[model samples]
Target: MVRLSRFVRQTFLSFVAVSCVVASAPSHADGTAGWESVKEAGVLRCGAAVAPPYVMRDPKTGEYSGFFSELCRNFGQNVLKVKVEFVDTTWDNIVAGLQSNKWDLSMALNDTPEREKAISFSAPATDYNVSFVYNRNNPKIAKGAHSIAEIDKPGVTVAVMSGSAQDKAITAVFKQAQIMRLPGNDETRLALMSKRADLLADANTTNMLLTEAHPDWAVAIQPNPPLAQQEVAFGIRKDTPAADIAVLNKYVSEQVSSGAVNRLIKTSVQSMLASNK
Candidate 1:
């Protein structure tokens, strides 16, 4: 009986040891699932859309180089210490990709209500106001037009990219203006350039960048001020494991406090504008 008891006790101990190992293995696996993918891939796959001064592809170089892209690169290399791989995406699809876990983060975006439901945002990287840009040659739209209501008339055609803040705001304020929906910033700019549209509603920073390139083609209008200023942020998956979010938050906070964020915005915004020329 004593020998039998001894054998049963040893068997139970062995089973307990195996169980502990199995449980601990999953904790390690869980940790690996969060930030590990970024580290293993050696790159943070960032979803991005063209936003001109803020973010855009270099026409000549065919490369993603803008203020927003630079911000992501800084975060990845300097803060998170990871490589950054930019994935060009439409505004419509960027948020969706985050939900599907297709991308690690969005390079730059406005933290709107709908997006906030599915993704998280870091601290504001930049601030911008709404503005209108018109073909310089046409010169129909003028300064002192503060809102869409002021500029949008029966004959005027306003072009805006779908899924952008300008699109939403124009829809709300310029109900009378013939609203033309385009897929991306490039298309919207083309619409204005080709005289297919009278005015292009875009962020002030974006308009400034465009004006820099096509000095003779397009210009920024003002009502002696801008429509409104909104913050730009990096969008990450809402379901992102807490560990990953914590690291990103820490990095962003540090960058913001140190003013590295300001330098990136100033340098990259100008560089993007210069590249257009």
Candidate 2:
């Protein structure tokens, strides 16, 4: 009788264990719980901060555009079969917004070790590096300055967008120079134009736009090895399933491999230049 009781108890325990495992398993075979939630809602929310060529918002019409935003819209409408919503945010809160579930993806975030601890990233849409933009005739900067050390000296001031990757990078490297952190890209560019700052530290591509806008005065220099050389990717919550990330990765890979990303960038640049003119 005791042997019979023991057998029954063992069987019950086994059944319970199996039930628990089944309950814990993802409902979908793809392991796309997060994505499923997004699909159910019928909208893919993308967090955006205005970093030109990456993210841009029209001041008058409140429309969102730029390469990354375009990718977001395309991925949502075409790949996920949903509507896209751009949630305006600042660089300081872009990652936090993703963490809090305020948005499904943070657009155009630079994937770095510091951010990886808090959130996951999709495959890179493009490479990113920091460069310094300054007036070619500026007496503070050397005629042929190619290294950061030449710019990192007392009495020289460098302007960067507040709470941006370039801000953090230049802060670490420029011990002797004053780092003037502004709230936005326009503010930083205006600082350089007004002589409030001597150097504008920003993304290499962004500085390219600045130089193009003011070719007579603005010129950019990329450091030899590069600063904050990293990948710009979409930021998602850390708990996001690998399958969901894979979907994003595949889409980004397709765009990059087919040269679609380059076309988007060119279009954005041309639009920006035309507006400036």
The 0-to-1 C-alpha lDDT of every candidate, in the order given, reads: 0.70, 0.83
Q: Could you give me the TM-score of model 2 versus the true structure?
A: 0.87
**Model 2, runs deviating above 4 Å:** 1-33
How many clashes show up per model? 1, 0
Per-residue lDDT over 1-277 for candidate 2, one digit per residue giving the tens place of the 0 to 100 score:
1133423343344334323322122322332336677777788889998989889889999999899999999999998799999999888888887888788899998877788889877777888899999988889999888898998999999999888889889888888999999888889989999999999998899889989988888989899878988888899888776556666776787798799999999999888888789
Global Cα RMSD, each model: 13.7, 11.8
Winner by lDDT = 2
Candidate 1 regions with alpha-carbon error over 4 angstroms = 1-33, 59-61, 136-143, 214-217, 223-228
Q: After superposition, how far is residue 17 of candidate 1 from its true place, in Å?
A: 33
TM-score of each: 0.79, 0.87
